[model samples]
Target: MRRWLVLGALLVLVLLVLAPFALIVLNAVKTPQEYAGSGPLSWPSHVSLDGIRAFWTRVDFGRKLWNSAVISGAVAVLGVLFSLLNAYALGIGRIRGRHWVLAAFLLANLVPQEALIYPLYYLARQVDLYDTRLAIVIVFTAIQSAFGTFLLTGVLAEFPPELLDAAAIDGAGRLRTLVRVVAPVSRPTLGVLGTFFFVWTWNELFIPLIFLISNDRQTVPVALGVLQGDRMMDATATSASALLGIAPAVLFFLVFQRTLTRGVTAGALK
Candidate 1:
């Protein structure tokens, strides 16, 4: 009886989580009249692609998608690299001031982005990086790296001491051991962290709003914001565009969900 209750509860939870996405997708296939007339929960009477067509024609969605991909991919790669190096150093190197450094990073993470935006804006201007792809990439990487670094550090902390001793016995230098031994064992953690960076950077809105000046250069979230207006928005088209923007992240998670889950669990065990 208890097992049945648990299964039922899980099913309900899944439906609850999926409800909004179902609404979005269903609405995307409906005409504007159907969307505005019927409750979103109701199935469309007829399927149509008009919504998607309108969104594509109205918004430069292709360019925005590419911009978001480039920024998010760059952020994910750089964040993982920096995080791995930091984690390896703190977890394995036993460097001085490690605790203080970790504390500082955590504290900095606690500071809201709003508090630092003004300073970051000035700094970007000073360096002549404002309104540029590099600016977005740098800010995204730097902001996301703090938590990724912490996560990698914790995972590395669980590493078996025996492995390090074994590598040392092989006369492996610190860099070599990190590159060859630690990284291999830590790939799962890397994948998990990289996935996180990819999702967050792709969805990020604030920094891009502040720094991105050109509509052509704006990422998906910023571009979506531009799509909104005081006039009645094409409900179908907007939903379709949102679905498109979310597709990559959704696909990424679907593909790596297993590895990501395993890595996180393995790190916890270690």
Candidate 2:
């Protein structure tokens, strides 16, 4: 009876989570006339591709995809590398003032982007990095790395002393040990971090909207958002936009599903 109840509860939870996406899919296929007649939750009489087509063309979605890919991918790779190096120093090297450093990173993660936007905007103007993909990559890399450092440091702190001793016994220095021993041991965690950084950076709207002013450099989220004005927006198009914005992120999660699962479960065992 308990097992049956648990299964029933899990099924309910899954549906609750998927309800929003299901709504997007449902409404996205309906024509504007059908949508107006039947409302958002009602099934469409026939399928329509107008909203998706219009959105895709208006935003040059292919280029937006490429721009987002570049920025998110660069931030993911750079964030993981920075996180590993910082965690190695704080956790393995046991450097002086490590706690203070970790505290600072935690505080950085706590600081909302709303507060930093003005400063970042001013700095970008000064550095002449405004309206560039590089600016997005650099900013998100730092933000993601700060959180990654917090995660990785705790894991590394519990790392086995025997492994370090073995590496040192074989004449491996700190950097060598990190390269040869620590990183391999932490591969699952790193994959998890990279996947997270990629998706988080990909979904970012505010910073990219402010920094990437030019249509040519705009990301998928920003470009789609730009299209949603009184003239461009309609109920069907809004539904399509929600679906469009979430699709790539969902696809990325699916691709890295196994890695994320492994990382989440890595610490489960003794």
Candidate 3:
């Protein structure tokens, strides 16, 4: 009876989370009038591809999609790379100021992202990287690395010192051990990190909005915002645009869900 009750509660929670997404996706295929007139819960009497077509054509969604993919991918790879480097140092290195360094990192993470954006934007301009994909990647990487390093550092701390010590005894260098041994065993953690970086970078809005002013270089979130202007708000088109925006992140999670869950649960256990 307890198990059944728990399952019932979980089912309700699932519905709560899924409801909005279902509404968005379903209404994306609906006509603007139908979407506006009908409750989100109502079934569409007629499927309409017009909204998707208009959205894609009006905004050059393909370009935005490509831009988003490139920016997010770069952020994910660079974010993970920088994070692993920091985590390995803090996790295993015998540096003098490890605790202070980590404390500083945590404190920095606690600081609001909004607080850093203006300075970061100015710095990017000074460095001749403003409005470029590289600039976006750099900001995303910097913002995300603190938390990523925190998680990766915790995972590495749980690693048995003996394995690293044995590798050193056999003449394996730090990079070798990190690549061959530490990384292999840290797959679960990496999965979690990758998923997080991808999702965050994909959905990112504020930074891109601040940096990229050209439509050709704009990300999906920014491009989607353009659909709502002084003239009108095409609800169906906006919904379709949103669905397009989230598709990549959703697909990534679906592909790596098992590993992601394992990584999350493993970290929880630790």
Candidate 4:
């Protein structure tokens, strides 16, 4: 009975979390007149493609999707690589002032983006990187790697001495050991971090909106967000926009969920 009650409670929580998304799916199919007649919760009288078509065409969603994917993917790869190198030095090399270094990374991570954007924008402009997707990738790689460095530092600091000893006996150098041993062992953790970096970069709005003024260069979130105030989009179209904005992220999460699960399980076992 207790187990059944726990399951029931979990089911209810899941429903609560999903309720808005379910409504979005419903609203996306609803005509504005039908929604006005029967209300948001009522069954749609008929499926309508108008909202979806309008939002998709207006936003040039395909271009936004490609831009988001490129930026997020680059950030994920660069962030993870940079984090791994930083953690390796701090965690394994026993570098001097390591704690202070880790502390710096932590403090950097603690600072909000709002506090740093002005300096970052200035730096971007000085380098002629302003208003570019490459700028977004570079900015977020640095930002995201700050947190990833702190995280990977802790995980790698606890790495097994026996594994290191075995690699040493095999005449492996630092790079070889990292590539052949430590990296493989830490694959799950890296996967989790990469997924996080990708998702966070994909959902970013404020910085991208500020940086990328050109409509053709805007990311998914920025494009959808800028459209929120337009009189051309009604409530149903707004819902459709929301769905379009979130669908890629949802699909990415589902694809990487196994990696996330493995990372959690490995952490638990350790």
Q: Give me the candidate number with maximum lDDT.
A: 4
* Top-down TM-score ranking: 4, 2, 1, 3
Of the two candidates 2 and 3, the one with more favorable TM-score, higher being better, is: 2
Tell me how candidate 2 scores on lDDT.
0.92
lDDT of 1 by residue, 14-72 (tens): 99999888878998888989878986777899889898878867778888888999999
Angstrom error at residue 225, model 4: 1.1
Against the hidden true structure, what lDDT does model 4 obtain? 0.94
lDDT at 84, model 3 = 88
What is the Cα-based TM-score of model 1? 0.94
- Separate clash counts for every candidate: 0, 0, 0, 0
Total colliding residue pairs, candidate 4: 0
| Candidate with maximal TM-score | 4
Which window of ten consecutive residues has the lowest lDDT sum in model 1? 224-233
Candidate 1 residue runs with Cα over 4 Å from true position: 230-232, 268-270
- Over the stretch 83-184, how does candidate 3's per-residue lDDT look in tens digits? 888999888774678888888879878998799889989999999998888899888888789888877887687788889989999999999999988888
Per-residue lDDT for 76-147 in model 2, tens only?
A: 999999999999999988899999999999999999999999999999999999899888998999999999
Q: What are the lDDT figures for the candidates, one per model?
A: 0.86, 0.92, 0.84, 0.94
Candidate 2, residue 263: how far the Cα is off, in Å: 0.5
Question: Against the hidden reference, what TM-scores do the models get?
Answer: 0.94, 0.96, 0.93, 0.98
